[model samples]
Target chain A: MTNDHHIRTRLRDKIVGIAGCGGLGSNCAVALARVGVGRLVIADFDKVEVSNLNRQYFFADQVGMPKVTALRTNIHRIDKDIMVDSHELILNPDNIPEVFNDCDVIVEAFDSAEMKLMIVETVTEKMPGKPLVCGVGLAGWGENNDIGMKVFDNVYICGDHLREVSPDFPPIAPRVGIVANMEANQVLEILLGKMNDGNNTQ
Target chain B: MEITLNNRKETIPDGDITVADLIRFKNFTFRLLVTKVNGRLVKKEARDQVYIREGDDVTVLHLISGG
Candidate 1:
């Protein structure tokens, strides 16, 4: 096969599942779609609010729309032919496996620490050997270079690894985008079987 | 006793130190954190009971959010 065909074939056979359709999930979906991922399974029960416009991938007009549907619409806008399995429901440990069973990689993009930990723990436990990409400590307007990636067993975590959210430090677009892109890149790396080259951990 | 904390070698008084005790010893005040010992997760409720031994790899990650 030609090099171009080989690249297309690889992207066309992989599926990614995102746990939240907020900033990280929505942006990651767009990146994956642009790269021609075969399918995406996205879940989010919350609706867009005016506050999410700062970092999330939703326009003001999309406020009040369920995040999953809004994200689906947005992803289609990027690549109309990309297949998306959108779920508009609150995800719990009991149902996560069912929703994302076929995914080769799962991205944990929840906003709360509790939810992030829950998804990471549940998915790792329920689906041993499946790789999970998660983000943490990307808050504030600190130096974007602080964001980095680390690999622990089957889990890949991306972010600054410091600077928790506070009244003074808030989640903004630039830093969040950096971490989200890192997560997306990690997914691509895992799918392409390049995870063992020794440069991914940061 | 000596243990590897986040990959750095550190020495503490020889005895059994629960995950909580180690956190206290390290002065980790961050509220949003996840602890793993030897590659297994130590949930919040189990921190006080989970013990760390010599040569055990412990990772304490703080989970905050921007996205």
Candidate 2:
């Protein structure tokens, strides 16, 4: 039962912000907390519902709870010491800056295409050099090989650029989980890699 | 002029086309676009002002989806 004492200590001071508490954000938050990220700023305007259970992290009992609050409670179950600051409201271009300005890296886990575009545009424009791990398209199934990443300076986009979820192509658990965890992995790589080799000006 | 776009070689019919024109000509309507010219980030506002040159390495990626 040995823990990653050294890795944990290194990550204990870092903060990660998640822009949505849906399939991508909730799971990424859990993964980051497990790896010892010290603080989290989670924002979501919606409440947990039965429909989201297929991919999101909320328990059946937690339905009707605001996504941000529900995710914070679930994260605490993994590690109570982790600090969580949750905002339960819609995130437009205006409030995003005030809410996530201090996070070391921001996770864009929104469901709508408009919100996704807005987050990327706003974060890259306003935050300047902040690292953003964003999920693009993981709708339907069986294109595992196609699920790769693209880099645009500070933003890392994971998932196929095509395929938006619709009535015909809905998001499922496995694909969502894979991309969500990929975002988490990117967060750690950015954080720990920076720690290991200082900042490499890109 | 020919340019490397998203790793593929593409020929742009216009001689002096900006990033905004390329996006419109290519019909890439997705708003979640991130454009890079020779590794330098070109913000959304500057896309119309940034021009694409021959042999330039350009990347216009639809980094997210609306769904």
Most accurate candidate by TM-score? 1
> Clash pairs of candidate 2?
A111-B67, A112-B66, A113-B65, A113-B66
lDDT of 1 by residue, A41-120 (tens): 99999999999999998989999999998999998888788899999998999999999999999999888888887887
Candidate 1: true contacts recovered, fraction: 0.65
CAPRI band for model 1: medium
Top candidate by lDDT: 2
Residue A125, candidate 2: Cα error in Å is 1.3
What is the clash count for each candidate, in the order shown?
0, 4
The i-RMS of candidate 1 is: 2.0
Candidate 2, residues A86-186, lDDT tens digits: the string is 99989998999999988999999998877887787787667878999899888987888988888767889888777788778788888888889989988
Please identify model 1 stretches exceeding 4 Å from their true place: A1-5, A195-202, B1-4, B7-12
How high is the lDDT of residue B9 in model 2?
94
lDDT of 2: 0.85
User: Model 2 chain B, poorest ten-residue lDDT window?
Assistant: B58-67
In terms of DockQ, the best-performing candidate is 1
What C-alpha lDDT values do all the predictions have? 0.85, 0.85
